[model samples]
Target: MSNKATHASGASSDGAELRRRNVPGESNGSAVPTQAEVDNKKSHKPKSQSSILSTLDEYEFLIAPLIFTFLAFFTRMYKIGLSDIVTWDEAHFGKFGSHYIKREFYFDVHPPLGKMLVGLSGVLAGYNGSFEFKSGEKYPEELNYTFMRLFNSAFGAVCVPLAYYTARELNFRRPAVWLVTLMVLFENSYATISRFILLDSMLLCFTFTTVLCWARFHRLRHESFSVEWFTWLFLTGISIGCVCSVKWVGMFGTALVGFYTIEDLWNKFGDLKMPKVELASHVSARVVGLIIIPVLVYMFTFWVHFLVLENSGPGDAQMSSLFQANLRGTEVGKDSPLEIAYGSRATLKNMGYGGGLLHSHVQTYPEGSQQQQVTCYHHKDANNDWFFYPNRNKPLYNPEEPIEYVGDKDIIRLIHSQTGRNLHSHTVSAPVTKADYEVSSYGNTTVGDEKDHWTVEVVNDAASNDWTKIRTLTTSFRLKHTSLGCYLRAGNVNLPQWGFKQIEVTCVKENKPRDVYTHWNVESHWNERLPASDPGSYKSPFLRDFVHLNVAMMTSNNALVPDPDKQDDLASHFWQWPILNVGLRMCGWDDHIVKYFLLGNPIVYWGSTASLAGFFVLIGWYLVRWQRGYQELKPIEIDQIHYGGIYPVVGWFLHYLPFVAMARVTYVHHYYPALYFAILTMGFMLDWVTRPLARTHKTIEWAIYGVLYVVVISLFILFRAIVFGMEGDNKQWRHLRWFEKWRITD
Candidate 1:
């Protein structure tokens, strides 16, 4: 119970469980499990602590992770409260934290879990959330953000030990654990991120814990229902939820868990002791524990989020009128009764697959389908509003006599109220979408013709007509272009500034009803007859609010095309991450005289990169030898060393490779997850490579490792000023800026 895996049953308790599973010397009336097989199962129980201490290996258990954690925290804490200035993304997240402290509802592209922690940290430290965390704005002297940095630094400290335990769990030797701990402690980019009020460090920390927990579970799965097995599995799920709550990038951790689960089940299925029917139980448990539990936790976090931020803030314009009504301070409409009518002026959002507001603007796409641009705008605007008509020949609605309900499948024409152009489509190809018919606002005359007519279809036939009726609060509707022989779709492609950067509206080639975004609810309705006091009628439920938040975040993320004019020199290319070629510009540019950079320590970085490559070669050689029967892999050694190397490599790629394909801007810190993976990989490989050398000449391996730590420590000392904030003349910065891309200013 002394170590972290006490729940998994300690080495002392493992004797009984090990005998139960293996039945030593009592084979199933046949060949007994070889010594190798017993070692494979028993290795999960770490050697007794007293035994390790007697031999001096206790330093690895007691000192390595702790020393590294202290080292990392000590390094990170140097300038924690020294300066109070807004830098890079701190302005965005810090401001979000402020809004949270103020109990104001706002929107973010990411889930609120990270911001909640940030705000909570500030609250704990006596921050009142009063400062405007604007770009280039210095923090007021009154706000002490030290606790915020310290909050994340605490997570970073745990990560140092997390790397150690995770590597050791893989059956890696003590040297591997040391390397992983040191790698995490000495990484410069990590050091800097830990010092800031950022979510990346927290994300990294949680992700590491998630993987570590899963690793322990994997090592102890045979002992089902044991406290350790249950605890690790439960912790794995909890850590997964925590990481994802911080950022969607945490989904990658879930992906890794999913893969591990499959591998687990697959191996169990082949076991003679496991009946095929038992596979169902395995799957069912995972579905509940891994899938259901994490989902519930993730959703619950949002529940807390929506509860706290009840007041309205800047994001009100990005949501439906009904959803906005729930936010305190929002000017919501009052209760009023109205009926569906042809002349009713209502804003129609795309009720197809893409959930964009049915919109039209004065500008036209320059290329093919050059009609007045009809697009799906995410924002609520006058341009998104439309007026329904029954072709030009039909007389204007006789409002005095009666109001006609425009029920499902009713033929209608939608005229863009702002542009005075009909929502028209033809056989011509859409501007950006291939093979899809073009859809645009086109009506040269004041009225629309056959080309403009569209058949109206209600999205949910089962839902109450009372809710779907025109002028009703957030009624869902769809439009089918009568002339184009196709349905309307809110295309995901974004238009240029000429079209106000909204999503394009395309005539779909098929009439697929499954597209969720195409399902639109009228956000704002205008009918003088329907009195302006119907706010309660438009109250959006929690699910609808969740959907609106997602739609808004997706659109915001998509619209993030890089603006060259706004692009900073600090933006790093995807390749620069591994080689430590560039780093973030923490404080600079005619703002703060002190400059800080988050570059990796070059020796650890380049060494890890080389180690990763060498590891691949080592694996290839081992496989070739095994195939030729020239070598027999020691099963016990394989678990701790070669196979152990795989988890981190997978993690590294899971985090790193996806960025290579990402179109959005990337920077060096994005590589830290992969960097952590590489460190673990190096740890496993070095332990394996040097074990023989250490046996023949014990001092050589320790000497090499000692040399490595010395180099790392020396580099950290040299780069400390740049890693932390340091003010100096240009001459001093030139020496610190080792790479040309690292723009450390005076």
Candidate 2:
């Protein structure tokens, strides 16, 4: 028969006929199948139904996940109670836990649910005390940082199993499961951060659980909605709520889940022939059970503690109930005064409400403070009134020309007739030499003011008057006030006679012969006068005020300049090593979200980048290869295997990219335990993508395997650079240096 006819008949054949043809063993009177027969049958069968439990025996299949889970557990639990000292935010969280245990419903930036969980752990650790939310006092010294960290570590341990379940839901093969589990085991940040008394590990655990539940929900949709499905959905919701309680960023998971539900609803109802109302009700029921129930579960998990806590007053309890009810009711207002007040009060109380902490105490400068200052070198009397001169200082006056001014020691005046603009009355000091004139304007000019602009004019060696402009006044500018002082303009409009060393006019005045000084000298004098100990001196205030300002300005200027040399220094000094510094620069010194980004959470940034890149690649690969072997690959067989199903392939790629990318950004101090879960998830995805291709084309299978090898090598190099090159000074340059090291290795 022809190949096409053979393929058609092969498709029509029963499993028994296929097995008989494929199996090597003789079927005689109740004899067991031979190993070779089983092997041959398995090889011919599609991979979708080929479980490791059947191929390697159940024992071997079970051992790997168990071993991986144990390793993950050990890594998390080994340093569980070792670090005695609390790091930066640990102290605040510890106090919050104490407060929660004492039943103090004190407001905090984070929801109270996470702290309540920590409080439960604290109680277990023998920290029975009255919680003082403000001073953070009454914390049990016996609990220690290690004990506090243990709770998160244990949660981190739970993540491995959660990851496995998630992978299994996606029908990942044994190899993919193992690869993901192994990747999670070695992820440094997830490991390190999990061992600290912070919310990140807990956040990660909850996020993994949510994803797992979501995946299960997706897989089990073909069956009628059962208690098991509801259970997973509920758990997923609880995890999301728990995450939100720990940090607001947890809401992202909730958003993702909601999106998934909408997609599910669309798929279920889009082609239905039922009435509009019936269809709507059906979709609504699914949404309520899957999406709404989980959200409520999450919210209720947080509300339970608030309701039960003794310190949570009746009003607080009412408010908590109201908030939960609002979420259920879909009353998502754009802004909530209560939430704003709660956040503001919590931050203020935590930081100590002294000095400028109070809103009323914040400094309020006058409106003109926004405008630049303009200083003129005109005469000032004892009362500091302008000295006016009536036409004595003409524009074309010679050095020996006699000048007259109508003025007393108490009052002075000046008149100028250039450009028809009058210097009718002004304060004039003694005659300032060219050098002195330059000094007076130094640093005194506002950024765009011409009087402050300085330029060096090159005069010809032969002629005193023949001078050429060496450089334009693009940045620096200098002015030479002659015997007759010139009227200074604030803008960059040039004086007609002031170019190329042409000394035209000089202003001589009759005030005390004061030494002209540069702005630097004035600043120096201010510094000296204050002597570093004087509280009222300008230097101290200027230093304190201008540091942030200057840093911001320099960073902005550096970005615009595009000088790679400057960028190299800036990146080295401020942008790369301490990822937080880069976040700060990105945020323009805003401490809210930028601070969180810097805390070594790679999923938010790097993971996102990797996911996007991986997604495009997968899409491209699928578009190219999906129909290439249509003649050889039967649709029925494809359905049975479905290893290369589009959904599974996408899921696997997304699942692993986050893990690998996050590992590349992990730091010693902050661990994201979810990376392990991510890796496991990706492995399953890869297995799905590879198995289909493998059955059809060995070359494609090997190509996929080669890609994985390259990915692993690249990840190894990246992790090495992050681990070895970073100096952990929380500066931008260090981060750049770390990046540089990675680039060099690459």
Candidate 3:
């Protein structure tokens, strides 16, 4: 007998009632029962096998998933503040919080909600000044770090629970919900990112929560299109908008929620063949819930800082009202040359750089000239060309010139010493004497022939094998000529193996054979001057000890400006190096922060790509196996629910396209959109995979299921290779294939 006929006859009657009650038990009767009888039987059922397992069938499919979600929450909140250092971006948030609580909203790169939340925490901690939370100070240091990290950790912790609810709402089995929650919890990316002091984790939390709410609404109230569904839809919109305010990447969540709402509306009306009154109400409710509510929520989150703060600055107001401002008027004021030019100013308002335009200008220089001019401000000379002047002559410094002393003497000394060493002493010219030589003794005098006026004697010291020369001479010369010049003269000199040593010289009147005067003994030589003190070596007393102490105190106390240097570093660092700097700033120093929010431990920034590929491969494998199972069941003629319907195909295609596009993008932030799409697609795919199992299966069906599994595995490997190879040197494009080239281009 056919499976459907069997279900209709004999024990199948009770089995149908069991299916209606969604209870697992043996049937004892052979006749079909009334709805009231089935309800009565359900009420009389015993629940002793397992409380938890029984609760799963009694309450809803979501209970087990919710329990699994607690694992993620615990991991995110565990030991969040191991690192005591106040990172660059954390300092910025700390400052924003301080200012915010003081009724002052400062303009920043992002909207106000994140800063407000952080500030609210600081206010709770009784933050006072920049130096209140320093280490070893009056305030508790542990509390300081924990306070700053609390919101991010809490938000991140909730994502696991949100994922569970999302999966359960899609009719996922307990195992699937547990798998997804565990993946979210243990996945290095999700775990690490929860500890950050940045917006990405918060954005993820808000986005995921919004998705969960939408899914719940879909499963429970979507069929009836109730007022409660509209309320949940509004809440979802608010969450999505709040996420977008934190980071623009959260817009992907907004889009997903919007798509789901529209789909919900269409499904409600289309099922009844678009009846006018029913369709109008459905369309109107979706318009209010999805479009109008989300826009309002987005604006509300963006403007809350402005409303709450008393003295919001012009910059703050501009940033908070960015979407409301007139772009063309803002553009006109920014075109002045007096303002600094850097780049296109279109994104500047949204990015919080008002009253400025960024532009690049070319510069040019003439041949053989050391001077250059900015081409925008100065016209180039007629002779200037963009060609290299290989043969152009430039003035060279003469070593003999006095002013040339400023040139590098070290290089000249090296060359000259090497040349002297290479040449023979006999080939060297003898010293020229233009004046008479003189000798003086403290108690006696000695005279020598004019040709032998100078006598040279060489002495060798045991410590050094080098010879030292003593020259005795009668000399007369003016003191001014040689005494104050670059070179010094001396008498009774001692030479070391390295070079010249302590020497002294006496000044005399020209042509006189006697000493006129001396400036004491002149015992020390000018070349042997002691090293001068370098002013640069000196550091401030504040910086050497007190400043860092102050910063520590401030951070610990949850005070404003915990570290001013760190705050400045975030702004300037991001402006200087946008890509790497922004990523690092957002990730923070906490390993958990990068792990949870970025989707993998950013320690291996590329791991997300691999995980993404693996996830898709699993989905593809499951699909192939499901198809194979269907083929095998065909022979048995067992009537089963065919799950791969028009809706599933549409959902999968819509969802997968975004992820495929994301994998090919250059920027990592683009992955958020891909993640949003992939998740929804997986949900739809799961729905398709499970629907067929609702019916009775024969042995042939089970065999087909096994064969399908093998087929899926093979197809996954093949598809993965094609997708991964298309990325080539770009690991980010691992989801794109040659056949899917449009994803890369898009």
Candidate 4:
């Protein structure tokens, strides 16, 4: 046959085959179908079914996330209000919220945004801020704590969908994305911490948001400087600020973003095709979105904090004398004598950057002479009051006598006004700083001892270089122990619970004249014989006050160390966290009271840890295979490994490794952020392991995934009691304990 005849014969045979198969709209061997036949063929399907499948195909990306988010919220809000009593750190954060509602300025180590949100929740729920929020305290009927809990729960619940979208942004397959969402949604620890007025939920929420936004931004690098790129970058910055505002731990998340940006910019810098102007634009955009915006947002939170808290509260003493003066109810440097005089009653403040007032109480030390405890107290109280009496060399300080100005080289006896005892230091070892002598209050007003004597040596006068009389709130002075020649010091060494967690007072034998801890100044002075100084002279600028308060906050935060004398059952090491060696008791172990334990699901945590290990192993195996002239992964797979696998590992390291070097007390909750990255890594591993199986052995791949889903869901059910609240005897529920170190039942 000719070439044209051959082509026509093939087409006729194809049409005959189509008609025999009875394909839709192609019956009776018709080569062309009319519009009526086409419409009839489409109408053979049910209207609702066709419409539903079309809608599913159109919005398929949103279906899984929406379902996961609803389930997440349901789980988190299920029994959030079960406990009417305060649990764990609610004692601290809840009280902070109350302080905000009452407009009472209180000092805490953490930033104010988290507590501000808590206070906002309280305000919305109509809480009066009258409740003390003591640990394990029962909530009043009108407290509406449930609403506050629900508000916090909302943040944690949203984290599930954020994880899902973040996985999708990382190019995870649908099954892997579902796994990531399921891990976060069912994680017992995350859910448990979210059910209270604490900051962890907010912190986690912002952290997840930052990571998700960063992933989106990274994916849009191909569309650099596009509106979508800029939007994600800006959102990442805002999320960074918010996360950090909740707690300093958020800096770890910030560091993750920072590392990714630096690497990205460095890669772009090496590209020869990139013009200098484009590079500059990239640099400027990152600087604005990552650095400037976050800083502005952080500072704005503080501005709001300062604007709201105008009245003096318990935290007034933590601030500088001048800053305290600015508070409405504070009497700092107000109507107080400017110059120190004999028989003057005053509070001696340590002149260090974050020092406390010299205070003594009637409670005796457990060891070291067993005398009345003298410590550095950060709060104002009557115990801080002291009488500056003249030494034995001078006549007994009397109100009837003429006003005697206390000058340099004057020997004085500091009498604890509350205890009628002198500030005494002896050769006995200090409670914490054993190298120094113990400082204590000893001897009644009628008795006398040389140890009680201290030389008042003025270091310098703030108002004048040439001044004989000591000045209040300005003169930097030292109290040299007359007998031991040691200087009275408060070096931020915190004491045990017996000492009320106050800074330890010590008599340092090393006479370092430049030691700020040894420096002392009169904070609150009272002398009926002297005239009040000018209040206008004590005006502290806002910027100076702001810096001073932040430094003070950091100093106090660093001082939170474990007491060597006692065992902190609540404390855990960083290594113990990953292995699930311990769990925290969120409330009392009372039989009637509802209890919550902060613990991760064993299956989820263990699998995440394994996934982290598996990442390194797989990467090593691939490198070795490539070096041996065999390639296991293609270019696309390599890119996936770099962006999805390596990036999450970096994030995990950034969030986790810092804890190893930290001197502060750490707990399992500290590991939650790192746990999130680990979860991502786990999702990546899941996808990597099942990728080939999904293409070839589809049944086996689905079976493995099915097993995982079942195991994860089953474990969540088993661990639900820990998050939802367990009551009655813990011994009865001991079967839930999976590890020897897990003290969950107890």
Give the top-scoring candidate (lDDT).
4
Candidate 2 clashes: the total is 43
Instruction: Answer with 3 or 4, whichever has the higher lDDT.
Output: 4
Candidate 1 displacement at residue 300 in angstroms: 2.1
lDDT (CA) for every model shown? 0.71, 0.39, 0.38, 0.84
TM-score of each: 0.86, 0.48, 0.46, 0.82
Poorest stretch of ten by lDDT in candidate 4: 19-28
The 10-residue segment with the lowest total lDDT in model 1: 21-30
Give the better candidate number (1 or 2) by TM-score. Answer: 1
- lDDT tens string, model 3, 170-284? 4443333444454454544455556656565777788777767765565445245556566676777677667766755566566666665666566666676667888788678
Best candidate, TM-score-wise? 1
List, residue by residue over 1-746, the lDDT tens digit for candidate 2: 43223322233233333222110111111134679987898898776567753644445445656777887777666634432334335666766777666665444445556767777777877776443323222234555445656776787777777766565554454445445554555454455556655676777787778777776666455433466666666677667667766655466566656666776667667766657886676576556765676556555655565454544321221121212112212111112111111001110100001000001111111221212112221111111111122222223323244433211111111111111111221222212232222212111111122222221212111111322211110111112232234322221111122121111121223222221111000000011111122111111122322232223223222223223233332222212322322321211122111111122333222432344345457656655676674353355334323322344333333333333343122232222332333354356445645655544565766666566545543553344323222322334434433433322111
TM-score of 3: 0.46
Better of 2 and 4 by lDDT: 4
What digit string (tens of lDDT, one per residue) describes model 1 on residues 288-345?
A: 7898888877887888888888887776656665666677876433333334567667
Residue pairs with backbone atoms closer than 3 Å in model 4 (clashes): none
Once fitted onto the true fold, the runs of candidate 2 whose alpha carbons sit more than 4 angstroms away are: 1-36, 39-56, 59-62, 129-141, 273-282, 308-364, 368-612, 624-685, 692-746
Residue-wise C-alpha lDDT for candidate 4, range 1-746, written one tens digit per residue: 43222222222222223112111122212334568975786699788876887677446567778999898888889888888998999999989999999988899999989999999999999998999999889999999999999998899999999998888777676677778888999998998988888999999999999999998787677778778789999999999999998999999999989999999899999999999999999999999999999988888888888888888898888776656666787777778988888889999888776789999998999987999999998878899999988777667777897888888888899999988999999999999999999999999765878888999888976567865888877778999999899999999888888999899999999989989789888888899889998542755566756776777889988877776877988899999988788889888888898888889987789999999999999988988989999976655467678888999999999999999998989888999999999999999998887776755676887788788888888988998889899978888779988776777775
Model 3 residue 633 CA deviation (Å) reads 11
Reference-based lDDT, residue 419, model 4: 83
Q: For candidate 3, give the lDDT.
A: 0.38
Candidate 4 overall lDDT versus native: 0.84
